[model samples]
Target: MTLTKLQKKFAEGIALGMKQGQAARYAGYSEKSADTQAYNNMKNVEILAFADELIEAQKSMLKRRFSGLASIAVDKTIDILQDVDASPQARLNAAKMILDYAGMEEPKQLNVTADVNQSNPFEGLTTDELRKLIDDG
Candidate 1:
């Protein structure tokens, strides 16, 4: 769609992260009425469609800029996983990296209870009990 000068500038400003009212004012819209103008402009179907295109274009640019980091991380983790000399903790971390790459974040259903009225657990223990606990640990 062919946009007027202000519409073009407004779209560009929005693409560059400006809020609607800010973009409208930057595009030479009246300062006092810019908020209303920005709201109305955002309601226009052509402007909405153009904004979608702008967002998708920016996504492509961003992906290109950061594309190599994921592969490098995966490769290093894989190497760690296959190395027999790696510490057990290190190998576990590498496995976690693979899970993270697959988008499997930690399991979320752990049930924990906190008793607000409960005093410190160790406060009731005698000195001998504390010494035994510390020695066991």
Candidate 2:
């Protein structure tokens, strides 16, 4: 079976992570380490295959009532991105990174706020701090 575009992107992420000796944590499994070294060592084609299934699993999980797993997956994706070395133009890459993780088409608009709303109680917090708060809440 052929890999889709999203599958290709996911496979590339795994390959990059493996090359850097960084473990990819997905669905509570470490893509690195002795237990999962084989998975981490998968080639592009193999990873593409694995990613196809993983994406399907994530979609199914999202359809259920569980609201928290999706956020955990996003956090894991972000951690993976940070562990990998991207080019200097990280902003452009961030958008692609997010879409690739979510296995979705490009969004018409992203609702992210660049600056804090002064009216918000935690408006003074940095983006990093805000992200933590949002994730924790």
lDDT per model vs. reference: 0.87, 0.57
lDDT of 1 by residue, 76-97 (tens): 8999999999999999999998
Give one clash count per candidate, in the order shown. Answer: 0, 0
TM-score of each: 0.58, 0.22
Misplaced by over 4 Å in model 2 are: 1-20, 24-42, 66-137
Which tens-of-lDDT digit does each residue in 1-137 have in candidate 2? Answer: 66545444445455344432232332223444523543443555566567566666667767885667778867765765575466546645665779876697775885875875567688689999999988999
lDDT of 2: 0.57
Q: C-alpha displacement of 74 in model 1, angstroms?
A: 3.2
lDDT of 2 at 76: 65
Q: What TM-score does model 2 achieve against the real structure?
A: 0.22
Best model per lDDT: 1
* Candidate 1 clashing pairs, residues 3+ apart or interchain: none
lDDT of 1 at 106: 89
